[model samples]
Target: EVTGDERYKDYWRFLHDGGMRPYIQRILDHSNATRGYRIDRLEALAADGIPAILETRTYPKIGAWEQAHEGKPWYTRSGRLEFYRDEPEFRDSGENIVVHREPIDSTFYEPNVIVADPRHPLLRPRRPEDYGADPRDVGGDARQARHVVLTVDQMLSSRHPLAEDGYRHVFHTPKYRHGAHTTAVDTDIVAIWFGPFGDIYREDPRIPFINEMYLDINPLDARELGIEDGDYVYIDADPHDRPFRGWRDNPEWYRVARLMARARYYPGTPRGITRMWHNMYGATWGSVRGSRENPTGLAKSPTTNYQSLFRTGSHQSCTRGWLKPTWMTDTLTVKGLMGQKITRGFVPDVHCPTGAPRESLVRISHAENGGFGGERLWRPARLGVRPTYESERLQKFIAGRFVRRG
Candidate 1:
């Protein structure tokens, strides 16, 4: 019996390593040989070096080309003659580039996402090592790089099952929304000074991927909060004790959350942030569920239910995440429905400062709905603490800064 083979395994590796250089060179040679004068237009992008390929002017001009290809049958009104047939110029132009229906796959190899093993030549740096670098394996830093900076789009809809959620099954729409105003390379939004790519908004750098999480609150969580699109809600997270949770805590956590929560309201004019579909992010295993459809698991859809975790101090609503203070004798506890004893823990969403308290569980109060009429009217509130902005943001900025610098 014959076993199936992985046809495209080496296909990508070979193309990236060997094909890219030749392909670019060929394009350059062909463009030079076939001058704009030969084609009679100034659309050639070869005037500048390879870097020019990324310029806006070099972007392909697809305007009239589309209309011409889609132009209706070329017939004259009076004689009903076909211009395309009668005119040699028209015919030549039309026959030169035929537009045919065909399927198109836009997937292309991205250097950052492709994992590079020891054998991959591209992973190797130049010899003699620049600037006192260690003479390590050719796979240098590539071996250490594990996480990929995924855009909200690819992170949400990729065929990877981890990319989806049960909410997609129930609502037929993604439950989470990640917001990104600009590319990671040039986010002008202010960040803290924990490191280089500091937190953009406040002085704190504990917020992780603030740009990413902001989208969740502004648009996605906005709907759940009963706030209309473009509307804002204030958050009031009470500082929790340090003992029940971890001792690490940052006092600025609450204030940072407030600032970030406010910033989400205005995502700027030009770089208006786009809300990413929810359930597309977070720890791979942390928020997911289990079932036959997804035996490994399905991400717990970030929903209105999770929104409850952020409600703190009176008049405060935490749609994004939560904040907890680090100190003893300040803890709160509550029991779960099944008497499951759950302890308070810091929200893993963002970074926290040293001596900051991790968030723990808290009681939730709700009025009896009459389903089991005669029950206590207003019961104790539910409890749980999520990561505050400072803690989360600091962790992300530090992690990213270290990775880029190292």
Candidate 2:
């Protein structure tokens, strides 16, 4: 959330990789300090020289040679274990240097589960039963309690077929908008951004800053068409640029794309810059052969670099819907407002009639008897409708069997 550079770099690597700018670098440094503090506290307790049940471990500086090494060890030991031997602090790491098992706590800590932060709104106790302490006894604002909660689009659903239902489908470079990389969907509920720009969510600050992939309709466009906040509209664009092949060549992708456009408006939009996210807009293709010709608007990437322009895929397709309604006027009023070209499209991620999860709408597909003909291996079914136990077993098997294989 601090700056655009860190976020984009993370996106590019398909991994969270990048250096932060000065201001953001400071925030990261603060986080490092907090981690250091925790290590220090645990070590401080252990420094008393008396052995306790609680185990404390600290990593020391590593030599240049050790830092450059990569790949898993042949013996199956993790690099973390291997790092300890050469770390500078290991010399005085005390006699008890072996790694010990972590203690199990029935109530607070649970493996494979994100423990409630007690403060995060999503995880915080809503009633007295949550904390096991009577709410009546614990007065004061409940909102102030640091509630640990998962924001709307942060967690992925176990029901999603894409998470693990590997029936085998092929993806090619040309089929994707970019070479060697395509739009990666985090089927989990996490909000997306243009690579790693920043999070836009108020509840969870971790929301990624996605680019506006669709043709954004500013307030002026909305006003001209009398479109309200949830009103539906078509995006007028040539499908030539939206090329899909191989696995993306399916009828479901087109149908899904059409349904994706009905998104809520960021109320009071500006005159110049379009504020639409990827799926926030209506159908990708619309035909208005009447006297009123739809405008041809230009979309720009955050950095003016053409390479960074909004590509076909990416979180912009799904995460765009999470942008809460904002005034259009605020964005368009920027300088060079009039000189820029403008296009309009309905926002994606609008409510699906079937009430499926929002991400389901953005999966690629085609219409019946359209350009794509046969059934594809990965057809995304609507949400809240997938199998439960079987799906879980499948996911566990896939994660266990295939994840580490590569």
Candidate 3:
């Protein structure tokens, strides 16, 4: 509403034209990589018009991006491609330069005393333990480390190891939902793309993959798990909630979030990996859950629809993920320009926090009656809150998509 409406465009225009200019200018001023560059060049190009530049018909590459500094010191903290910073922190942290740390799996085995092939003199065998530290395992902390440590030994261990050890599979979720930006999750758009196929040729926006959410598993793994194609299976994100400081007696610490979805055995899918197309469910009001008759269920928008429980299928619920706050070198500098207030301002998309759920492990199994007792099963919104489903705005969306679908 804010971006499309002209009334709302003024503020946007000011940020792009007024504020963005200075921000870019600041980067250009400080970024030595952008040495010998000026914003005026861009301004001049814009002033003369793009049509004039097009008349030349010659493509020209510009600046440090092209082969770095042709004849000058390239811009950087070191005025060169900085593999190492002169900063003491790099030296203290043992990351003085780019170095390859073996995957945690490599640490599981004793370090080979013999070098590989022995063709390269520089190559040397790795030590099981190094840097005067006892043998350690790289667990939950990809905030970084590498070693074969039982996750039970360390609270922070690698998630991949979990699937390899106890958990049966690693559930990978990618942002595949088309919201206001792509398909734009709205009634008018949904009408055009309600079902999977609009034509027999099988060429339509509503492809089978996009119409609903399903678990993509390898055919081999599917057979092993006793899951047939189109079977509604449960994906249990293990360790979804763990007790604080080893809460062995507390049952709450062992809770899991189970997401139900139809299984699709893809031939090319790796044997152990399961991918759930993310952002598809729980993004809209009536999001699909496990299947048509049984969805993951949903909670009404707490901020908007209080009484209504939306069927926004589950995804994030199945993981112990946390928002990863962006810690850029210098993201937030200035605010409050062109009537855009300061306190309410949002960090730009580039600096926005994201959920790092790679540590969330899951195992697929048959879901009887949705899911297990200790698992979080999606439930429909029960009435009790203000701004219920009776609200004029939400009712219209429901009516347009589900009610008027005759």
Candidate 4:
């Protein structure tokens, strides 16, 4: 759809010729105008904002920090980058230096072994001398000068099980804006990032029903479960009992927020993978088909499957807890906001130093009954109902026996 790079020759654009430095300067200038006013007047304080921003967010490889601390050594004990840190955690972990290790959850095709490269790929600095990655520091274990084993490794080794069902696929929850100008899922607004269309989707008849929820399965996997494309299926996970802040989800790993969605066959999906797009069809809104055959009720305010009782309303219902991925911590010292480490947080909401809602091992079965309705419960109680006419003779007999026809 892109006609040409210079389509709007005069208007600003991120083209091939321009570099990030200029683009960033423009953003810094704008921020200094609007954002810098809180500390002091923008006119007075704006001139100094660019240097502050560069030293903070942008590439600091050769920025103001280099000049500010010209003689002072960096944070390391050696005043240089140390591949083998003298921390007990590093020595204990066996990772004194860098080593190539596989992902914790990787289904083992080969033995889970790692090859250590203690020497620098580019600069082979000698050990006890120059302090580049020393080969002796590469191999880790107790008694060996190798890398320290990490606490994260032990945490990863403790396998967390979700579902016992024979078939649990590698699950990913993808972000599909059922429509634009929405919150977690779809809403009544047809919004672009900026401009007049921000509230436009409210009246547009062409918007698809956004509340209906569905899980994407590979075509080959669909056939194995006897699930045809568009068939309803009940998706669930194993019990997980942990404390979730109760803002978006709950604490239990196995606690299931059950809802039903049609099984959609996604093209090019490999056999052992599944995906569910967020917030679409459910019991309330999108599922209701208009009564008129010809169809004219298009302009009405849009409604998705609202009021999902089990929280199965969105794909994140199954995503719970955390998995620590990376090693070490990044200390970001900020000013004015009381030295807020923007990347780090004490709680889950502000920052989850863990991974986001990505992969899950889940169980899927055919939802034969109409989803979210009491179809099965209502059927079982049908035998208890008796007609009043049939019970009239019994009522009279009981009255005569108890009251003697009074």
The candidate scoring highest on lDDT is: 3
lDDT per residue (tens digit) for residues 230-320 in model 2: 2333332113222232324665554434222221233344432233333221212221111012122222222331221221233223321
Poorest lDDT segment (10 consecutive residues) of candidate 4: 138-147
lDDT by residue for model 4 (18-124), tens? 64445554555566233332322433556866423323433534544643566644433344545654344334333445655433222211111233443434323
Clashes of each: 57, 49, 10, 25
Reference-based lDDT, each prediction: 0.26, 0.27, 0.41, 0.40
lDDT (tens digit, per residue) of candidate 3 on 1-406: 6357776766567585756775566666665445445676767877877432321112453535433535454434334555643333233323334433332221222211121233333333222254444444334333132222222223323234455555666567665554432241333245236322122232321222334356778867877876655455766553424212243455332222235555665666676677765544343322222223222222223345321111222455454433322222232322333222332223454333344443345667865321122222211111211122134555766568646534
Please give each candidate's TM-score. Answer: 0.22, 0.20, 0.44, 0.41
TM-score leader: 3
Q: Candidate 1's residue-wise lDDT over 338-367, tens digit each?
A: 223433322232223233222211111121
- Winner of 1 and 2 under lDDT: 2
Off by over 4 Å in 2: 1-216, 234-238, 243-249, 258-268, 277-406
Ranking by TM-score: 3, 4, 1, 2
Q: Which stretches of candidate 3 lie over 4 Å from their true place?
A: 1-75, 85-94, 101-165, 177-211, 238-257, 283-313, 318-360, 368-406
How far is 117's C-alpha from truth in model 2 (Å)? Answer: 58
RMSD of 1: 29.1
